[model samples]
Target: MKLLFIGSRLYDDIDWYVKRKNIESILTESNENAINLDLPDQVFIVPRGMDGPKQVAVMQNVDAIVPLIGIDPPLIDVAHMKEEIEQEHGIPVIAANVRAVELTSNKIKTKKFYDEIGVVTPEYQILDSPDDLTLEFPVVLKQGEGQGGKDIKIAKSMDDVEEYFKNFNQALCEQFIEGSEISIEVLGFNGEFVALPPIYKGETTLEGTHPLSKVKTGPCMVQGLDNNLVQHTAYKVAKNLDSDGIFEMDFMYSPEKDQLYAIEVNTRPNGTRYLTTATCGVNSLCELVNMAIGEFSPANISDKLEYHYSTEIPVGDYNGPCPNEPVKSFDDNDFVVHGPEGYQRLTARADSKKDLDNLISKLL
Candidate 1:
């Protein structure tokens, strides 16, 4: 069947579509970015933010549309574009509806949905006014549509809270839940769903800029976690929101209080799409396409995939170098990157963390 992969600028998205055999794949890009070789059936680079019918008409001949756009500040509208595209064109949407995407993209809205369904989230308050800072100090405030802790701030005192809010427009304030934070990636088709093994998020620092910002994801963090609990919780969120196809849900675990707080819901493929697939052995793109084609059944939904874990490290210490193009390194030795099925290792080389950090950080 013919499929149009939206948000195709991302490497993972491109890789996903290209890997599927015997399918017509059209990759759309926002800007004139370079595409990795070995592409799928067909690739097209559409102008950025071309969501209106005039733009999407390019794919009127395609059977279904699969969006691969990442989360953005205008995320609610971005996600809702799925429905807009479907309605504008007489094609079937392979994921959540516009209303559902709106609910999940807006943090406050998502929390309310979770509350209505009896799902446990954090003790958070949406600050519509300056006086809404009635909560005590040490509260964490994150940007509603922000990612990787870009505009996050911690208020140690009421004064600090007030001062910070004056600078930022939209934010969600929550009582500090001190403990390890864990994130899980799940893939779903129709009403049937499968929760992949959870991954541990490590060293989330807001030191230089934002503390609540995400730095890196490690192996499964808390052991003996009720996998069933995580699965049930995630499924409930997906089902409650009537989410379809692939999605990612994050959660925070307060070990001291023994509480599980539901975090934000990623309505689109996350930055770590490859990492999740590496850990879970689930071809989200393939499965998503299959589900879109009505190939999923309840009996085959729970087939668990295996994922190994590993980390990124520098190569060596050859300090002094002066050249036009900067140098880099990757560690094949460090045990940080591992999986049972596939051979995972550092794909490049560098000297120090700072030097290695210069590599293209984004997944695109």
Candidate 2:
């Protein structure tokens, strides 16, 4: 089978699996200098947007298009392309549909979706001005769209809300739940969905620090919160969205209130993949390949499940030791190192928690 993968940013994560399956790999990138271009069997430097990929897929007669875009800005365009390509061209696009993207791309819409689906999310209001604020202080102020903590602030007072409004006219302000931050990656394909183990991304702070900057651990050892509950809720969200590919959902567990609140969902490959794979042997990136090749099913995923203790630490400018070939894979190595210079992170796993602790100390 031949697959046309859009964006080379995440191709490396699944290159080994593609080679093992002997699937012809083709990739298209907006920039010629993008990383992981060497991993694909063929590469096409195309103009930005979904038009270039659509034309390339038709010209090449590729069997399917698996969009590997890791960011949010291009998802809406990709969703439109998915609709047109699958309907007009009769070629499958392994990604979220337009309806799913529209509901998830906007934070306000996602909040309403949770309410409609009976999933618990924090109480929030769309505030146009500081005077319109009804929620108490220490609220999380945010725009309708953003990722990785962009355009987000924890407002503590009217002055904070006013300061936030100076930059943006409207904000989706939520009653801040000061508690443990958790993320789960759910894989959905052909009307089937599976939620992997949860990752414990430290507590929410008054400063609104994102999980990206904090150290994260696997299997979510948060007291008073069950991982099964997280998995079930994530599965519900994915079933409601009813889309393909990956659904990375973020949630906050309040120990004080004993409540679990859904925060956000990204209908694409996300930062949580590495830790999720480290904790559980199922790689969502590889599963995207499975989805494209008609090898995806609940039984197939259940067979690949393996539990291990894992942790990811933000080790800027890693001067530590390196692993063998297939650096992204945890097959031989106990860890994987990733990210750009001065902000790289090291993720490692072991059979037991005690062994994981020792491995991390020695790696550091």
Candidate 3:
């Protein structure tokens, strides 16, 4: 089987899996300097949008297309391309459709979607100005579109709201819920979706600290929250979207209120994949390759599930050894180190919590 994968930034993460599947890889990148350009069987330096990729997919006559875009801006374009390619031709393109991207790409739209779908989300009001704010202080001020905590502020006062408005005229103000921040990856393809184990991303702070800077653990042991509830809710949301590929959903469980609030949905590969792969033996990136090859299903995911205690921590600069293989799977090693210099993170796993602690100590 041949696959045309758009974007080379994340190719390295799944190159081993693609090669192992005996799938011929053709990649398109915006620049020649992108990483893992040489890993693909063939690479084409196309322009930055999905237009070039769609054209290349046809010209190459690839069997399928799997977009590896990690950012939000180009998802709409990719959705359009996916729609056209799959409709004009019979080739499968593993990605979210236009409606899914439209609903998820914007924070305000996502909140409305959650409400319409009967999924609980934080109370929100669109603020054209600071004077229009009614969500109360300690609310989360955010733009309609951003990721990784970008343009997000915990407003403690009117001054903070005014301070935030200097750059943007509008905001998606939401009531800040102080509780356990959780993330889950639900893989969907051909109308079947499977929500993996929940990951605990730590408690929220008044400073609006993102999970990126916090230590996170998998198979969430939060006392009042049940993993089944999380997985069921995530599955519902994915089915509502009715899209293919991966959906990385962010949620918060407030023990005080005994509520689980949906925060965001990213219909692509995300930061949560590393810990998800460690906790459960399923790798989302590798699964995308499987989706293109017609191998993704609920039964297949069930067959791959392996329970383990896993945790990811920010080391800033990891002076530790690397994995036995280039892949991120923990089959050969207890730990996998990722990220760039001065911002590296280590994800370690073990059979038990005690073993996990000991493995972490040894890795550190």
CA lDDT of every candidate: 0.58, 0.92, 0.91
lDDT of 3 by residue, 318-363 (tens): 8766678864666677788888788889998889999999988887
Q: Tell me how candidate 3 scores on lDDT.
A: 0.91
Model 2 compared with the native: what TM-score?
A: 0.98
| Clash count, one per candidate | 16, 0, 0
Evaluated at residue 145, the lDDT of candidate 2 is: 93
| 1 or 2, greater by TM-score | 2
Measured on C-alpha atoms, candidate 2 has an lDDT of: 0.92
RMSD per prediction, one decimal?
Answer: 7.8, 0.9, 1.0
**Superior by lDDT: candidate 1 or candidate 2:** 2
Better of 1 and 3 by lDDT: 3
For model 3 the local lDDT of residue 64 reads: 95
Off by over 4 Å in 2: none
Clashing pairs in 2: none
Who is ahead in TM-score, 1 or 3? Answer: 3
For model 3, name the residue pairs that clash. none
lDDT of 1 by residue, 26-73 (tens): 656655555442364556666556464226434347777666655554
Evaluated against the true structure, the overall lDDT of model 1 is: 0.58
